[model samples]
Target chain A: TQLLEQSPQFLSIQEGENLTVYCNSSSVFSSLQWYRQEPGEGPVLLVTVVTGGEVKKLKRLTFQFGDARKDSSLHITAAQPGDTGLYLCAGRANPGGSQGNLIFGKGTKLSVKP
Target chain B: DAGVTQSPTHLIKTRGQQVTLRCSPKSGHDTVSWYQQALGQGPQFIFQYYEEEERQRGNFPDRFSGHQFPNYSSELNVNALLLGDSALYLCASSFTGTGYGYTFGSGTRLTVV
Candidate 1:
């Protein structure tokens, strides 16, 4: 079974602060995706990184896929109270049987206080 | 366009009772997947359905079953519910040829008493 380990299980920072969370695994993946979920709601996709050493940015969030495809990271710049939520990283196995299934990390819960 | 939709936004069931949850895929989507999310934890994959068949499943038990309809809608049924089964059930939809990401529904919150 593949497992994704996420660091900084909990984060609390003031507005304007910057933070980075990581997801690591021993197994390689075809792609990695980042998601943000508010309480009582399902996760919303933030970005998908398909290539090793690839980086993608969306507004104040930056996502990076590792060179080995076994790790990924999300960095938030100028965090705001609205940016507070649970951040999740999921990985897709190489295409094959049920490759559509996502292996998710425990997630990083962030709270940005104004 | 509407995204994935799940029914029974909240449910409370006694142990050993049976429950069935429903999901409708997003427009133009052909596949549906179910997940279980415990409080403060990430969602865990339960299974995926495509073409009215079970394409893949996760480590869940047989008590957890699902069915997909011709219209790409799906149902998840759980039998002899245990308190451990209490969690938020989420449904996600995606097209076969589309990229790896999925569109998720708000989810159904189940509380097993």
Candidate 2:
């Protein structure tokens, strides 16, 4: 079975700290998506990276897809309290809906203390 | 436009019972997908519907079923619920057949006792 393993399941730091969350997989993906979920809410998409070795930035968050398209990462620069949330990385499987559903990582829960 | 919306923001049910959760896709959406997310975990795909037909499904059992109406709204039904089923049930909507992105609903929180 295909799986995405995320690292640093839990992270807590002061408001000004920076951090990076990693999502790795042994299988290639057609696309990779990053999402953030707050308590009691569904995950909201933050970005989608389809090309290998691609990087996209949204405000202070930098997202990168590995050169092999088998992994991805999210880097938060100068994190703020608002950046505290559960960060998730999901990989889209080709032929995708059935034999390959979006494989989701367990997620990284971040807590930024103000 | 209104984003995706789910009904019964919260529900409490007992094992062996049945429960139904509703979801309405965002405006202009044509496909719906269901997911289950346990505490502190990412959402797991349950099934997806397009053109009012089930086009795809996940690793869940038959007890977990769903339906998509002609209007693109959908419902997730679970029979003989188990405690492990307790989790946030999220519904996402998107344009199908083109591999577009999805917009998710707030989710129905189901706590199986």
> Which candidate number has the best lDDT?
1
- Looking at candidate 2 chain A, the ten consecutive residues that score lowest on lDDT are A94-103
Give each candidate's interface RMSD in Å: 2.5, 3.1
Tell me the tens digit of each residue's lDDT in model 2 across B1-113.
Answer: 89999998999999999999999999988888899999888889999888888888999999999999999999999999999999999999987555546788999999998
lDDT for B1 in candidate 2 is 88
The number of the candidate with the highest TM-score is 1
Predictions' DockQ, in order: 0.61, 0.52
Please identify model 1 stretches exceeding 4 Å from their true place. Answer: A96-99
Over A1-114, each residue of candidate 2 has an lDDT whose tens digit, in order, gives: 889999999999999888999999999998999999999888898998888999999999999999999999999999999998999999998844322356789999999999
Instruction: Estimate the overall C-alpha local distance difference test score of candidate 2.
Output: 0.90
- The clash tally of candidate 1 reads 0
